[model samples]
Target: MAHKAEDRTYDVIVVGGGPSGFVAAIAAAREGARTLLVERYGFLGGMPTSAALGPISPFYFDDEQVIQGIPHEFVQRMVADGGSTGHIRCTNPHGSGSYLCFYDREAYKWAALSMILEAGVTPLFHSFVSGVRVEGDRVTGVSVTNKSGTSFYSASVVVDATGDGDVATLAGAEYVVGREADGAVQPSTMMFDMAGVDTAAVKAYMDDNLDDFEWASEMVAVHPYSERLPRQHFVGQGFKRLVKEGMDAGELHLGRDSVLFLTTCHPGVLHFNSTRIQNVDGTSAESLTAGEIEGRRQVMSLSRYLIARFPGFENAQLIATGVQIGIRESRHILGEYTLTADDVMSGRKQEDVVARGYFPVDIHNVDGVEGYGEGGVWAGLDDSYDIPYRCLVPARLDGLVIAGRAISASHEAHGSFRTQGGVMAIGQASGTAAALAALGGVAPRRLDVAELQAALLRQKASLRRDPERAREERRRAVQAVSAALAEGRISAKYLADAGTFTGQAPRL
Candidate 1:
């Protein structure tokens, strides 16, 4: 294929069409910037679509809908399309926040595409960004390759929403990979879905065998397994005894010791986030290939073990696996300000806050240590923390901003903001800033923070905590739950839980 240069120029060109990239492009275009979105895959939704990861997390914090704007609107659209359960209170012990949004991946793709196109974003799918076009310290454009050939697309500002920080790395930006101590990144997983599940049998088994779940005592303290199991969406992380038995019987061999699954909008179908492949660097092609192969192998063994030993899986069939292995941790770009663990732990506020992170510091075991069920280390937060605009401005690179999991944050802090909801908020901020910078003929680093914040507010993005709004949201949630109970969309068993529910609106 011959290299070619495109004549058209864009005000903002976003790389990688994941959650962040998808929203970044839309935000830029809606801001009246000539934005172009480049994606390797044919569709959007990033990790949720390509890696089969779902329910979007951390939509709520301290009983309030902290993350709104594009993310909230996206879920509302999905709910209206009958592809999501809307925002429901999370029952899982290791969940990010009080509420999570569960949706169908196919619906996610369609909704994302429709939204971006409606925003006037020019999307170039099935295209991979091969190189960064840099002039001195500033990036001017990117080299993209597709079926037609290699072409150059020039832009005044670039949003690196590639989850791995690919564009920033290529642009000579400083970065750190993995944990600071051992340089080992988090393990990757191959997410899969199974159909024909006997959910009723599974719920009964959970009701009967509380001791099987390591966190059952903590979960039951709030809502019993029976009460939580019958909702429109469900998440479970248990079956420790059965997992041990399978491993002892030489039937299962995976890094995790428990079964982690989430219920989708479809009946009798469950999404599995169980296959764990350790010591794989997502930035390396060779490592990703090996991880994918090992992940599929684990999926096969785990699926077999589940059908043979688990209560509801006796007649279940594996319906689909992720298109790619889910990469939890990757390269973290060094920016003007590196978000620290203390910042996240203390719910630190900043004068230039652009987004709020509500998810807990959830670091999956990099080395697969024993006694860590599901190889997870969870640190909960009482409130959401601020993500400053400086975290998105690369310290050493010009005309570029980072988004998604690749933002400037310590390894521990990254664990929280790396989630879909947080990244989407970060993406919106970055795109809006980029558009403002381009239109004002200023660099991203020199752009005024107050102006950006004002733009976000005008767009209905939540920047600060509001007690009155929180109370209203809680009331709306309660009414939604009550409506669900009244309409019989959920089992009457959930009525007891609904009695305690004080949350947001019914599905949009």
Candidate 2:
């Protein structure tokens, strides 16, 4: 059932369709490139869709929303459709002003498809990039294979949005994998959602037994699940005591100290990101296969523990499981700039900055343990750090720019920039840069930063949202929410999402 090579050419060809790729193709086409987006699966939304990573993180930094442009618009649209929990702040003091938004992954797939089409980007699904035809350091063409056969696609520029940096690697782009100490990446996760639970009961237990729960920070009040009501959401926190009991009794097999869960658009349903399957490198086919099987077993075991022991889940129902195993870290290319941990920790502002990230340096323990030891994690700041334009340009590789979790950053820095919101911004930048490069027939390295910045601003991209002004905005919003609460017009959960503005944190 195989056919001969069919040739096609475009101004830009982007590989992957997850968080970054979804917007990268759209951004490229909007910039007037004849763009094509290729995906291994039938649907888009990448990791969030296939791997079920929910609650997009840190689109905001304290009071200011840092990531803008097409990516912000996409989330705003999802909000209007009741598919998102918009801008819920993490109250933990140790947290990095992380903005959390729980979303419906199923709805996101359709939203991504619609946006890609509306932006005039062509999408090819159920296809994998099987080969790359490179001329020296530049990739001239890519070969993709599907059920029909092999097909070749030529593009003036290529964007590597693959979370693992796979395409760039094949194009002779040098990449580093895992942490510097050991050749091991972060652990993989397989997520699931549960239904038919008394979330109220769960909340009551948590609020009453604050001593029983282990928090990301002691600064965070034991606001229960119901505390996340009206705006109505939950996330990877709650009930460490129950998890410990399960582990001690041999009811649970995972090593994670805290539970990872989130809310959906659906009431009485919650997403769980608890299972940790370590030692799986996502780039390997065999590894992914084994990871999937192991992840599923963990899912079943964890599901059983929830129903049997957890307070909120006395009548819990296992609803759905992720289609693919979620890989946290993988191959990252050496770019013009290798973003360092010191750069991130010092809150370094770059002259040629492209995007800003406010998420914490959250490294899930590579050994599948609960917490970090000596060098595992760094909760550096609650402020924003800019990602430089140089980090997108792969060194010694022409016609290529990297996006998503695979962008050039140290293991610690990558933890922050790898957040979905950060990658989305990087994706938009990648697309715009690629389009400009293709139009002028120049390599990405030679493109002017000023022109790119102007283009991004015109598209409503946010390079900065002044902390003072943003803080004032937060004050006004929170005052309004406080007024509503004073009048007994809004519920506590509803107020939590709006007026409780922990406004613009000081610059680190």
Candidate 3:
């Protein structure tokens, strides 16, 4: 029942309909490119919709909104639709000085589709990019398989926003996967939602027993628990004692030690991001299948445990789970420039900067166990770091640019920029660059950075930092670090290891 269709051509083609791909397609089309967006799923919004993830994070660094343009516009639309609470201050102790945008998954799907369509981007849904047409060092087009049968789509420029570098890999681009030392990727999660929860009871219980929560003491030091918990949107992570008791009695099989929950705009519905599936390779179907199965099992166990023991959850019901397990890390295509851990930690700026990452290095443990030898690593940043255009341009490859989590970065750096806000900004940059390159008849690497930056700025994208503010922030951070050292809040070894912030070359 398969029929061959005539090959379609476009000025730009973006594969993947996630955060990055969605924005990329819209940006390309708005820039006057005949753009096409291909998605494996029938709908868009990527992880937030398909993976049931909520509360998009790192929209702000300190007091500044570092990520803007198309991503911000999408949020505003979602807000106007009553699908989101807009951007709210993050109260989580681990992610201080950040903001999160909470929205309904169903709303995200419709909003994304409407925006892409309004921008004149052609969207091909339920189509998988099975292969790419490469001539010499450039990718000419992609071969996709859908219900209509196999078809070839030619484009002047291609954007790989697959979140796994699928197009780049198919086109023979060099890439790396997982941590460099051990080759182990971050653990995956299966996010789920529950309804019929008594939020009042839960909040009261947390307020009374703040000592039972992880980082509760630190959070309370700044913002009181009562003031921090919003009725419509709340995020809490803690339940160590309960989880331990469940594990001891063989009632829980999940690896996580704490329960992470986020409240939705709905009265009593809450999202749970507590399920952890370990050692799952996202690129392999077999591995993903196993991970998904395990994740569902964990979700069931977690929901049952919460209902039986947790306050206000006695009558809670598991409403829905993610369609698939959420992969935190995957293949990073090697580009002209690889964003390094130093670049992210030092808040390095570059002349060719296209995007800024404000999220901290949040590496979820590769192994499933929590609070063991290496449960996880969360290193906060005092300011934002720049991501150069070269990170999107694959080395030795033409006609293609990478976006989302798969953009070229060291393992540690990827942890920061992989968040939704960071990737959306990156998508805007990559899409604009792709359109400019295709229109100008040049490779993405050969496109003028000035032209790209100007186009992005005109589109309301946030790229440059305020020089005086940046200097003041740096000075404040230095002072804080020194004060911490003197007060014994940090060790001398930690300061030595943090390296100098004086703009000098790092010592061997």
How well is each residue in 337-456 modelled by candidate 1, as lDDT tens digits?
A: 999999998899999999998888888777663324445667887568999999999997888988889999888999888888899999999999999999899999999999999999
Q: Total backbone clashes of model 3?
A: 0
Report every candidate's CA lDDT: 0.81, 0.77, 0.82
- lDDT by residue (tens digit), candidate 3, 145-249: 998878899999999999999999999999999899987888899999999999778866766666666532111011112222343344666778888999999
Candidate 1 structure, TM-score to reference: 0.91
Q: Which ten residues in a row have the lowest lDDT in candidate 1?
A: 216-225
Candidate 3: give the clashing pairs. none
Rank list by TM-score? 1, 2, 3
Candidate no. 3 TM-score: 0.88
What TM-score does model 2 achieve against the real structure? Answer: 0.90
**Which segments of candidate 3 are over 4 A away from where they belong?**
1-7, 92-97, 216-232, 371-374, 466-508
Model 1 local distance difference test score? 0.81
